[model samples]
Every structure is written in structure tokens, then in C-alpha cells.
Target: MVNIVENIRKQIDDAVRNSVSKAVEAGELPEFEIEEVTVEIPKEKSHGDFSTNIAMQTARMAKKAPRQIAEIIVKNMDLEGTYIEKVEIAGPGFINFYLNNNWLYDSLKDIQRLREEYGRIDVGGGQKVMVEFVSANPTGPLHMGNARGGALGDCIASVLERAGYDVTREFYVNDAGNQIEKFGISLEARYLQLLKGEDAVEFPEDGYHGEDIIEHMKNYIEEHGDKLLDVDSSERRKALVEYALPKNVERIKKALEEYGVTFDVWFSEQSLYDSGEIEETLEYLKEKGYTREEDGALWFKATLFGAEKDEVIVRNNGVPTYFLADIAYHRNKFLKRNYDRVINLWGADHHGHVFRMKCGVEAFGIDPDKLDIVIFQLVRLYRNGEIARMSKRTGKSISLTDLLEEVGRDAARFFFNTKASGNHLDFDLDLAVKQSNENPVYYVQYAHARICSMLKVLESEGIKVPDVDEVNVSLLDKEEEIELLKKLAQYPEEIRLTAETLEPSRLTRYVYDVAAAFHSFYNACRVKGEEEEIMNARLILVDSTKIVIRNVLELLSINAPDKM
Candidate 1:
């Protein structure tokens, strides 16, 4: 929870403002209300530790050139008892503050003090948040899109939790919709084709064509022994659905669990209809004048919410649409369950549905802004420099199970989240399983493992990791050591940013950067054979780096192996 980086930035911001105030009081510059002072870390080391553009921002108000304003502000600055070692005016009146390495040293102590609690920040203030993702239709096995959504949604929920949110992971089961209806139809046709002849029954064109349907029917006949042969078709289909839907749902649960995703709620869509919530939602929309009955169908006025057209909530047959159930589901999340925020991760195909769903939420008097839907792009699996689609074992499209078996859960989860959700990801099957540094997951885990191995060897030689107070952290002034400390200082701010932007990929990149920094430091600094004081200091640094790497990997639900 101790964010040294943010604390330093805040201190600099206050210092800048205080200097501007002092300049005004000294009659060196005209008095103007400082709206905001922005402090940023310089990209180039020669530029300085921190940079600000306060001079340029105040130039117009002070009626002076920016460089002149910069000189006046710098002249009035009180740098005593602060981390600022010196200040310089760079190109175009940029005020760059070079700081002593005290902040990095303090960050190391903070890491040693906080340990696993290092990267946590109070950004959410414990607001209740529900993240619904990978709500794939339980009609078949999950595919690559579902895999990506699972990784992203789980990591986002973890990031939110670390950012102090009371988070709930949920999966909205589409059990009552047309998809389930088609599922039943597909199962019934498969059952009849298996029990009777394959040519006897005609499969519906819109029914599911996956082999899983046939497999389900086969298992059902093996268990039930043609007991449904004498039953009516509608009743038989209903029975088939009753037997198979839960199995498919359970399979989905198992796959996601194996991929390190567990939901706090497995919300069933049929529960809404069974509890009359869907009807209540429709009635609520109608009472609010957001709906109208036309052509014997109930249509929602989506255009009222800036949509291009109206949408039908119920068909002429009085059957509710999936959109209506979705409204009811979100209403349950907001009104019934009373979550402060509801985040949904949807696939690219649902891009157009995002706006209309927001409209539906607004129709029920809920703030549509509270409903955040992330539409992630498609995933292409590549192997041996070619697009790989089918499973080597099943000869069907790759399922989550197939992916886990091939590249493993860590590789699957890490690779799926290596890119932002909005970008297209081509999962490299070859690199994912590789043990070399070409694989990012392996590279990061190897860094952690390398540290663990080093510590283990030191422990065997009776050179244990020292406490922060036991080491003179001032000795960590090497470039590689400072770089690693900077990366360590960034973990808390990174989590805050990830929570704010709802992008877990930021943490993925941050962890990789940490690994790279640690590798560079290890290559340059010798931790064990140095003098007692310096060795203890570098040992503390190495241990802190190990803790951060393990924390990040654990947050991502990836394994941090102790040995490579």
C-alpha cells in the first residue's frame, strides 16, 4: 500500500506549487491560481529523475516567457530536507529535478516491509464490483475467444481486488435463451439419430453441429438405455436438455477452473424467468415508456438512447429475447445485488451489442456509465509458422482443454493476457512451450527461479537474506541496481493504473519489465562474493525483486517455479 513512486510525485507537485506561490509573494511573478501541476518521470536518464512543465503552463498567466518563469520558480524553490539534489531547465523551459537515490532506497525498505502486500493500493476503496466474463454459451466446449476472455477477466478482477475493490467474479449462463433451445433441438436430433438410424431423423439446419452433441446423446443412451424412445418429441427434447445442459455447464466450469478462473457466481439465465425478473424488467421498461407494443411484438425504444434503430425485446409469440434477459441480468447485478460497478468482458462479435445493452441498463433507470463492457478482439492460434485450428487429438477446433494440454495452463493464461484486450492476439504455440527466453512467461518465471536458486545456494552456504535494516541500502547506487529499484517502486503505481484503465495487460508488461531489470542487475552486480555491507545490500535487493516477481505471477495465476 506504500506507493513510493506516487508519494514522490505528490511531493514534487506540492514543491512546484509552493515554489510558484513563493515566486508570487516575492513579486517575481504575477499571482495566478495554479490549476494543476504535472510531474512526470523523464524517459532519458540524462534529462533528470523527474520533469515538470509548470513553467510553460504558467507563462500565459504570469505574462512572462516560459524560460523566465522557470528561472523565477527555480530561484524561489526550497530544496532542503527533500530528495531533490539539483534542478535544471531543459529545452523549452522544462523543469527537471534530479533526485538523490534515497527514494529508491526507501522503496526497497518498503518492499521488505510489505512483502506480498507491496503492490496493493487503495484506489477502489472497497467498492463492490462484479466482473462478468467468458459467459460462453453452454452448448459446447469453450474455444480460444473464451480462453482469452477468461484470462483477461480473471486478471482484471485480481487487479481490482489488489486495488482495494470488493470484487465478485461471475459467469452469466445463457440457459434460457434461443441458444439453449437450439441446444435441446440438437441433442434430440442426435439422440434420435443414434437410437434410430442416422438417416431417419433430419437435423435442423440451425442446430449445433459439434461432435459434442452426438457424444452427449451417446452417453445419454448408454446411461438411460432408450427409455425416451417411447416419449413425445417435445418431452424427449426437454429431458435431453435437462440431462445435458448441466453437464455442459459443469464441463465449462472445469475448463475455466483448470485455466485458473473461478467465478463467485454462476448465474443462470433461466433463474430470471423462473423468478419473474425478466417479466418485471419488461414491465418496468413499459411503465417507463421505453417500450411499445407494435406488430404484436414488444419493441424497446433504443433510438431514445441515441441508437440508430429500435430493438424488439419480445417476439410476436410473446417469447422474450436474449436482450431482455441481459437487461434483467444486469439489473440483478446493479439493483438486486447492488454492485457499485458491473464489468463485462465480451468477445469481438458482441461489439455492436455493447451500446444497446447500455441503453437497456439506462431504460431501467440505472446509470449506464456504471455498466462497463470490454469488447475484446479475436485470437488466432499459430503453430510452426501456420495457423492452427484443429486439435491434434480430437481433430476438431481447439478447445480450452486442448490448449492447456499442449502449452500448459501458465503459458495459456500468460500468453492470452500478454496483449491488451482490444488488440488481436496471435498465440504462438511454439514459443509458449519453449523453455528459452523467447517465451515471455518462461522468461519471467526463469527470473524468479533464478533468484530462488541464488537464495537457496546462499542459504546452503549460511548466507541468508538480510533484513532491510541490516543492510546499508545506500550502497545500491549502481545503474543496474537503481534500474531494478525503479522497477520495484513502480509495482504499486502499475496496479493502480491497471485498475483505473481496466487493463490487466499493463501488469503483464510491468512484470516483464521487472524481470528484464532483474536480469540486467544480476549480470552486472555480484551479490554473494562482495564485501559484507554491499553483499547484504544487494542480497536485500535480489530478495525484494524475487518477492515482486512472485507476487505478480501469483496475481496473474501463473506459477512461479523455484527452479527452471
Candidate 2:
């Protein structure tokens, strides 16, 4: 369906064309531009529906007062087949139109006709886009910080799919990093402690200290037997360390899925190693003169591409750094998969690393514009005014699994969507559990379920959902009823605007507003058996509200249960 804004613009265009033709025919001013007309929502809803600066823009050219131009434009205006209730020049010649309720009733009819597919458009036109997110190293179960990325990435993928993009969700496993090695050693110490019944653990102070490591150790002992514990060589040790990667990744994957975060691809860091892509990337960078020898290791002169200083790509031991593998990984995403675009969802701490990746992307011959990096600021979780900062390595960061256990997937998604990505979020568990007041997620969900309850009650009485378009929408003229239709009519514009800004928080706020509008309409009117035409129209409006609320909640990856 055409968006209401565009539809209104067409009406304005027709009016302007007639007005301009009259002026040209009368020779008021030799040829004037009629291109500056605009129709945008007014701040004060009571003033008018949408205000346009077209009259003011044309006043200077027409050599008339802005009011005079507005009068001429209004005189030529035709509201036939449109919803324009009134057009007024107010506050220094601003032309504002008040829309009649019919505009909204029509949108409600379309919503009933479209159902799940309402508010949808083919804006992407079938572009292939890959989203790589929550690619946290497989050193342990997802931490609370990782949970934020998981929820965000999953939500982004959902929205893209709705926007008609061919979306692929990817999780990059950095199993070949220093962090993984530390994780394996931590498991080894736990293995020894469990085998020999030794009380003291040989794990380093900086290694993972979570109790889950003990479980991993017991499983390894059960599988590998006692001989595996006393392996003494560095080569065998690294082999055993690499052996634990799958186990760690399995734990991470389970936690994410349980939290309602799903990925289509698990792109391994070892693949970059296995395919010699890291070596090829370094050599390619060398060809670009971005590599140099520093401190007996090869470094990428990232400063040339706006880094604070050069970064080592490979150590003296000939092992490439994590960053090299990341570059190699992204290189394949564009070159091999041939994705039209790549979106990297990284934590705030990785902000400094974005420049070099962009630099490396350029050096690899792919346009840097194609690689989009979204850096989410750090998340500070709280459980009832007290901060939750339990870490696995330091025992100071909250476990992601535990967070999911405390809050269901719906609440977790709501928690993440509560704040803007750029702002630091204090995800309070207590707030998430609250049923009412300021908790936007539950608030919207409650509204959805209430309507379902009302529908079921009506259903029991043999009332079926009406074909609203078949009904006479002209009967729906009550103030609150008209208000809902207006809100319903704005869905297309809302979706486009949210996608344009890449701001899901826009929907977060919008869901509450939509719910409030529906609630107001519900309480102020009684439509059990009154005018069948208006009854069907109101039902359609309610149905569309439910559908849009669900769409918005789904975009945030929050469940829109018919029962809260």
C-alpha cells in the first residue's frame, strides 16, 4: 500500500499544479519553481495533521505574502478522494492540513487485508546482505556483554528480513586466539585437580575462574582418560588446547539459542588459517606497503590509514594476530560470499580496531563503504539498583546463561532494546520482570494480549473478524476511533524512517504509542453490536494495531504473546 505521506504529497502536487497553471496563465510572475512543497507532521496535533512550508517557499518568487500564497493554494486545493479535513495558514504562513478519519479507516482496511505482511515493502529489492554479530571468542559461555550483541544482531537480522533483504546471520568463532589458549590451560588445571584430588589449581591468576571449567575438565577426563593429564610438551599441550575449542563453542552456541539468538553460519577463525587467507592477506597488505618489521615481528603500518600507531600482524613465532584473522574473515565475507554489504556488530572496546579493519578492507580492494561497522557501547547490568558485574575470568561479570535463566528471552530482548545503542545501558532485571509502568516491552505485550482476550470473548459469542473494507468506514467518526486510524495510517512511514536511521529504538518507542492509542480507543467506545459497518471498521483498526505491535516486538526479537 502507498504510504499516507506520499499519498498526501500527490494531493498537494495536484493543487500546486493547478495553482501554478493559474499563475502562469495570468502572468503573475514569469515561470516559478513549484518543487519545494512538503507535507510533514505538526508538533501540536491539535493545530493540523501535516504542515507544509511550500507556501512560504513560493511567496518570495510570487512576490506575495506567504498567507496570500497559502490562500491561493488552498483555493485551488481539492480534498476529493482524500482525508484533508481542513487547510489553514497559521503562525507566519505555514500551511497545515487536518486529515479526516477516513484516511486512517482506509489504512485499517489494508492492514486487515494484508495481515502478517502489512507495513512491508520491497525497499531492499532483494539485495544480499550478511550480518556478522556476537562473534565473541569461544573461550567460554557467552558473557552478559556478549548477550547484548547476540540480542542486537538477531534483531537486526529479523528487521532486514522484513525489509526484503536476503539476510545471512553469521557468528565468527575466534577459537585460535590467545584467549582460547588461556581457556584450555584453565581446563587443564581443573582436569588435574579433578584427577589427582588436588585442592590447589595450577591455573594462572588471569585465567578463567568459573566453576563451569571444572565440568569441562571432568568431561575431558572421561573422554581422554588419565594419560592425557600428564602430557608435558608444548606441541602436545597446544594440541590439547585446540581440542577444547569445539567444547567451548558448543557451550556458547547453546546459551545463545536458549536466549533466542540464532545464527545461520558459524564461520570459524581456523578456516582463515586453514585456507592460508591470513598469509595471503598479509602478503597483499605487504604489496600495499602496509606491513613492516617491528620488535622482531611483522607489523601492519595502520598509522598510514589513520591508526594511532602500527599494529603487529604476526609475532616472532610466525603466528598471525587475531586482527589478521578478522581481516581475513571479513575479506572472505565480501570476496567469497560476494555479499553486497557486511555489518560487524562489535563491543565498544573494539572501537579503536574499526579504523584498521576499514584500512585493511581498502587494501584488499573492496570499497570501505561496503563494510559497515556498528560499535555498541558497553552494557552495565543491574539487578534492583545493585550492579551485576561478575566475570568468568575474574568472577566479576554476570554469566550470560544465568541472565537468560533469570529473564526469559522476551524480557532479555526487551532489556537490550530499552536503550539506544550509543548510550550506556543499565539493564535492570527487576524492571524487566515488572508487569506495568515504564517497562515498554511488557507494556506493549500486555496490550496485545488484552485485545486477544477481547477477541476471544467476542468469538465465543459467534462474532467473527469482519471484512473491514466491506463495511462502511464512514460510520467510524468518534474522536478516539479516528485517532487510531491515523496512527494505523502512519505505519509505512514509520517503518521506512526506522530503517533509514538504523534505529530500532524508534520502534521501541512507537510500540508503546501504538498500544496507548489502541487502549484509549478501546476504553472510550463500546462496539459490541452497534452499527455493523463501524463495528467492522473498529475491529479492523484493532486487528491492525495487534499486527503492528507484534511486528515491532518481533523486530526487537521480543515475543508478542497473545497472553502476557
Candidate 3:
């Protein structure tokens, strides 16, 4: 809960307010109500550690040039008790605060005190949220898109939990409606062809053509010996689906669990229809005048909610559309279960569906803002400078299982999370498995391993990492040492930023930058041959870096191997 960056920002804000008040009391500037003060890290270090544009913001009220106002505020500024070493007025109207090394020392101490909890914050206020992702159809194996979604959704949930949210990860199983109907048809064709030859059966043009269907039928026949061949076509298809659907769903679960993702809920779409939720939701929509009858179908007035066209909720044959079922499912999340917020991770093709779903929620008298849908683009896996689509092991299209088999789980997660959700990713097969610094995950893990190795050698000679109070932290004044400490101090702020943006890629980039800083420090400074006091101080610093790196890796569901 201790955010060092936020603390420093608060300190600077109080100092700025007190300074302005003193200036007004001393008659050095006109009296006016001050709005909320803004503080941010300066993009360029030459400006200062932190900068504010309060003077520019107050220019009109003060009736003076911004530089004049800034100078007046600075002259009356009191730097006592604040961590700021000095306050300077920069170009036009900005106030830049230079901090002493004390903030860096406190950051190091906090890390040692909090250990695994160093980067956790309370920005979410413990709001309950449900994150549903990688809800691939149960008719087939999960592919590359599901792989990426699983990584992003899991990481996003972890970040939210760290930010003090009551988070639940969910996977919606599409085991009903049109997809299942097509699945049954596909299995029937495959089964009839296996029994009566391919020429006797006509496969539906829209049925699933993947070899998995054929395998399912083969396995079924091997067990039953054509017992269902004399049965009705509908009954035969029903038997095939009953035998295969559960197996496919189980395979999906096994693959995801192996990839280090386990959901809190495995929701079934069929449950909505079975529980009469779909009918209840449509009746509610009809009561609200958002629906109409046209062409023997029930239509929704989507244009009233910013959509360019209307949508059909139910077909003429009395079967509800998938969109209607989706509305019912969300209703269960909000109205039945009472979650404070709900987030859905969808593919890029569902971009248009976002607004319409939100509209559906509003039509039912619920606030649409409670729902958020994030759309992620596709990923292209590259091998030896060409697109790789087939799996050598499965002899079919590459799946999440195939990806995990080729590259380890850690590489798959880290590489998939290196970019934001909206951006397309080009995953390179060669770089992911490389053990060298060319690989970012390996580079970060190597930093942790390097520290572990250093600490091991030191402990062998009876030189253990000392406590913060035992080490003289002021002795760490080298350029690289200060840079590394500064980087260490940024962990809490980075966590806050990543949570605010709902982007785990930001956190991934933060750890990579920290590793880079540590490498630079290790090359420029000598921890082993330094003086006794400096060695102890550097040891504490090195161990702190190791802890932060491992913390982030654990958050990402990646391993921090000490030996590697």
C-alpha cells in the first residue's frame, strides 16, 4: 500500500500550496483560490526530478506573466521537512523540484520491509470485478488468438488484484446453440462416412471440416462397434456430441492449466437458456419498448443507442440469437451476482459488437459504463523469417498446446505480453527460445540469477547482505548506483500506471528497463572488491533488485530460475 512515488508527489503538492499561501500572506502576490496542484516526473532529467505547471494554470487569476508568478512562488517557497532538496523555476512557468537521495534510500528500505508486497497499491478500492477471456468455442482446439488472450487476460487480472481489486477470472464455454448444432452435424457426417463409405453420406457444407471430428468418430466406433449405426440420424448425432463435447472442453482446460492459467469460473452459455434467463431478458426488453416484431422475428432498436442499424434478438423459428444469450449472460454477472464491474476480452473482429452489447445493457435499465470490452488484434508467429502455421507435433494448425510444446511456458507468456492489446504482435520463434540477452525474458531472469550467484559467493565467505540500518546508504553515490536506485524507486509508480491503463505491457516494459539498469550498474561498479561499507550497501541494493524482478515474474506467471 506504500506508493513511494505518490508520497513524494503529495509532499511536493503540500510544499507548493504552503509556499503560495505564504506569498499571499506576505503580499508578494495577489490572493486567489488555487485549483488542485498537478505533479509529474519530468520527461527530460535536465529539467528536474518532478515538475509542476501550477503557475501556468494560475496565470489568469494572478493577472501576471507565468514566469513572474513562478518566481514569486519560488521566493516564498519553504523547503524544510519536505524531501525536496531545492525548487527551481524553469521555462515560462514550470516549478521543478529536485529531490535528495533520501527518497531513494526510503524506497530501498520499503522494498526490504514489504518484500513481496512492495509494488502493491490500493487504487481499485477493492471493487469487485469479473474478467472473462479466452472463451473459445468448445467445438475445436484453442489457437494462437486464444493463447494471446489467455496471457493478457490473466496478467490483467493479476495487475488488478495487486491494485486492490476483488478480481475473478472467468471462461465462458460456448456449448450451446448454432455452434453445437453444427458440431453435431459434423460428427454425424464423419460417423456415417466411416460406417457407410464417403460416397453414401453428404457432409454439410458449413459443418466443421477439421480432422478432430474424424478422430472423435473413430474413437467412438472403436468403443461401440457401430452400435449406433441403426439408430435415427438425430439420435446418432446426439450420441456422438454427448461423447465428444466434454472431451474437447477438457482438452481446452488441460492446455490452459498447463500454460499456467486457471480460471475462477468456467461458465456455460447453455445454462442461461436452461435457467430461462434468455426468455426473461427478452421479456424485459419488450417491456422497455426496445424491441419490435418484424418478418416473424423480434428486432431490437439499436439505433436509439448510437448504433447505425437495428439488430434481431430472435429468429422466426423461436430460437434466440447468440447476441440475446450474451445479453442474458451479462445480466447474470451484474443483476444476479452483483459484480461492481465486468470486463470482456474479445478478438479484433468483435470491435463492432462492443457498442451494441453496451447498448443492450442500457436497454435493460442497467448502466452501460459498468461493462468494458477490450479488443485485441491478431498475432503472427514467425520461424526462420517465414510465417509458421502448422505444428510439427500435431500435423495440424498450430494450437496453444503446440505453442507451449515448442517454446516453454515462460517464453510464451512473456513474449505475448510484450505489446499492448490493441497492437498487432509478431512473435518470433527463434528469439523466444534464445538463452542470450537478445531475449527480454531471459535478460530479466539473468539479472535475478546474477544477483543470486553474487549473493551465494559472498555468503560463502561470510559476507551476507546487511540490513538497511547496518549499511550506510549515502555511500552509494556512483552514477550507476544512483541510476539503479532510482529505477528501484519507480516500481510502485509503475504498478499504479499499469493498473490505471489496464495494460500489462506497461509492467513488462518496466521490469525490462529495471533489468537494463541493473546490468549497467553491474558493469560499471564493483560490488565484490569495494570497501566493506560500500560492499554491504551494494549487496542490499543487489538483493532488492533481485526481489523486484522475481516479484514481477511471479505476477506474470513466469519462473525466476536462480540458476539460469
Each model's Cα RMSD: 1.7, 3.7, 1.8
The true-versus-predicted C-alpha distance at residue 547 of model 2, in Å, is: 2.4
How many Å off is the CA of 537 in candidate 3? 0.3
Q: Which sections of candidate 3 miss by over 4 Å? A: 20-35, 60-63
The deviation in Å at residue 312 for candidate 2 is 3.4
Which lDDT tens digits does candidate 1 get at residues 450-471? 9999999999999998878877
> What lDDT score is found at residue 299 in candidate 1?
96
As a whole number from 0 to 100, the lDDT of residue 372 in candidate 2 is 83
How many residue pairs clash (N, CA or C atoms closer than 3 angstroms) in each of the candidate models, in the order given? 0, 7, 0
Clashing pairs in 1: none
TM-score of each: 0.96, 0.87, 0.96
Which candidate model has the greater TM-score, 2 or 3? 3
Model 2: residue 298 alpha-carbon error in angstroms: 3.5
Q: Candidate 2: global Cα-lDDT?
A: 0.77
Ten residues in sequence with the least summed lDDT for candidate 2: 388-397
- Residue 368 displacement in candidate 3 (angstroms): 2.3
Residue 556 CA error for candidate 2 (Å)?
Answer: 3.3
